[model samples]
Target: MIYSGTYTAIKADVPEFFMRKFIKLERIRANRESIQKKLNKKWLTCGIFTCVAAIAMIGSYRYISGIVKVSSNVNGKELPIYCVQTDEKKVALSFDAAWGNDDTQRILDILKEHNVHVTFFMTGGWVESYPDDVKAIYEAGHDLGNHSQNHKNMSQLSDEEKTQELMSVHEKVKELTGVKMQLFRPPYGDYDNAVVLNARENGYYPIQWDVDSLDWKDYGTDSILNTVLNHKALGNGSIILCHNGAKYTADALDALLDGLKEKGYQVVPISQLIYKENYHMDVTGRQIPDAK
Candidate 1:
């Protein structure tokens, strides 16, 4: 405006040219202001849209996560809980320790370094053999579960034998670490309907893994890693089975944790991963909450 006013004062020297320049500058100024106003309004609209979308996303996540906390039932049958039906990217790592202690301490050290706590289902025999390992596992804040006494298939055992298998290990763990084991993973992952019923009757929650790392097979570390991370069942609330005695597991531990974390999974214990009561299992072995 100041430039325009100065030009206007010198308009008498070149009237037509100065008038034309004045009009052109005024038009340019008006257009710039108009475009800036439109841009400001557009930015305001985008801000509102972003806030609304974020709120909607949070609501959806909560609604999905609420399903796992709610418990459901299926027709009086004692079903083993395999995985939880949740939208959270959380997963549980369960180790069945029924054999050698060669890799136990190494696995524990790796877990400690990563700050990831996993569940260890120890047999009575493993506890008897590696009493200090049991104490160390408990002291390190990992979940202790009953993996039976002799590592025999629960399906082949009578009800009394099953009870003994569970109780013997539970008692030994309690004696060793003062931690009572309530989660049971049947030896060899072998369990029948009766086994499930017996476990529940004995106040233990039978757990099964959806993602099997096949660490028990003693395959290479790469194979175990590929098996788990590539498994189709790898998803939210997935129970992953590993072994404390696997040759490759200790070597694979850091990479396995990194892969799971990179894929946005929070490794938790089975005790924290599963529902204690009021839940039902779907035919696919996924645990769902009872519909309200």
Candidate 2:
């Protein structure tokens, strides 16, 4: 038999009996909601922190990898970035052929007449423009260096872009000359750590000059010669920088060679100048082989 109670009693009993169950159910639901909320908050916080952390890491990597500038000098000078070697009296006469290949034959003729070998940094476009000139440079027993495909600043490019620029020229030169280029000089002497690593990865040594002829400025022959002769430090090994397209450079070439010869300095290709197995990057961004 069902036991009935007074309305007040039923009300009281209803709550008494079900209150604990209801309370327990409500507690469970509230606990679930609280846990869910907590989890949501935790997840949100974690996601935000993760994103912030990722951004910070990316920025730090870019800064350290030289992908972006972390600090600027007070004078706001764009930092020069090439590893330079200055220990040796040996100077490398490296010519950059970008604008005109027409005069390449004349330059080659002059070099041939001197019986002196010079390193030629040829752009892919230049190679394309003058296949015979590229051939002549290789066939003449001079060292060939990859000068990038488009003559763009390789340091400013992404790793992939840098690889493409380097590899394209390397492959093209190899195809044309049947010799893989083992040296690299960035166009305009612009390079950074990325360039250095990219060059190293590609089995090429980075080459930079200790003395610049400043022939690109169309400096007079006397000025160019004086710049090379006066500013050039004679030692066991050194790499001299000059452009092939400059008239003054072409004019200064014979004089510079003669002066170097007079100083008892042997002008040699960069490979022979350093003559070491390992290369190191200097503070000035110049790369030199570790002295054996």
Candidate 3:
């Protein structure tokens, strides 16, 4: 009987020992499962971080590529570059129409005939006087820029007056052609610090010609053509200034275009030539090219 009691006691101890072992095993499995879940969460977080970092890097690269700074000299003043640069052989044909609308159709015809594009800077008075000509200019796929209201010297005017001159022309042009003027060439190529600031405030780019035909001086066609031909070699990103009122200018237009073509220069608008920064004109009147 003593022996039978000892055997029962040993059997009870065996069952208790097994239950304790089973509990320990379960605890280990629970701990392992928790560790695995934590590892997965950490990996997911790393992936998300990597994706975000990649996107940020791509955005920064694009932002950097889209902007470029240029510096060039203008009339012996150092100016920052505010325009983009293109490798394309292009030249912008800009006409200052300060007086007379009779030759408007002729100008348009010449452009259309050559399938060439040009920019016309029209004064407010001229636009009001010749609405039909303005319409034809717009319809012909030509760009319209501002040349002030009354063809006054912008440099001589105060800041407020400059603003008025620009805004008045802007509004008038918009009303007449349903197009906004993005560029302004000061009347008589005259401008100052106030003019530049006022133009910037009003969101207009002040454009000046790199080459002057001097046709307004009644230079004969050959003389005007020679001036352009001589300065034409001045390189890319040149703005050639000519007037519509000059008979010689009209006569030289076709020849000048032909010469520009022969030289393999593509004529584009001034808006396409400048960068986005506020540039100060250099002593030589060229916008400095901004370092990328």
Best by TM-score: 1
For model 1, state the Cα shift of residue 39 in Å: 75
Ranking, TM-score, top scorer first: 1, 3, 2
Best by lDDT: 1
lDDT of 1 by residue, 101-185 (tens): 9989888998998899989998899899999989899999999999999989899889999999899888888888888678999
Per-residue lDDT, model 2, residue 148, is: 88
Off by over 4 Å in 1: 1-77
**lDDT against true structure, model 3:** 0.75
Tell me the TM-score of each prediction against the true structure: 0.74, 0.67, 0.69
Per-residue CA lDDT of model 3 for 1-292, tens digit only, reads: 3234544555665786775575567678878999999999999999999999999999998675443222233444423222334466766778898897666788778888889888899999989988888889899988899999988988788888888888898898899889989888888777666677678679877777777888889869899878987874446767788888787777788888888888888776666666557433445456554444
Whole-model Cα lDDT of every candidate shown, in order: 0.86, 0.73, 0.75
| 1-292: candidate 2 lDDT, tens digit per residue | 1123233454565766675566567568878999999999999999999999999999998666452222211133332323245554566677887777556777778788888898888889988888888898888989898888999988789999999998998888889889888888888888766777777788877677777878889869998888877873534555677778787777677777888888877777766665345444444444445444
User: What is the TM-score of candidate 2?
Assistant: 0.67
Query: How do the candidates rank by lDDT, highest first?
Result: 1, 3, 2
Model 2, global lDDT: 0.73
Candidate 2 stretches with Cα past 4 Å from truth are: 1-88, 232-234, 279-292
Better of 1 and 2 by lDDT: 1
Every model: Cα RMSD to truth: 15.5, 12.3, 9.4
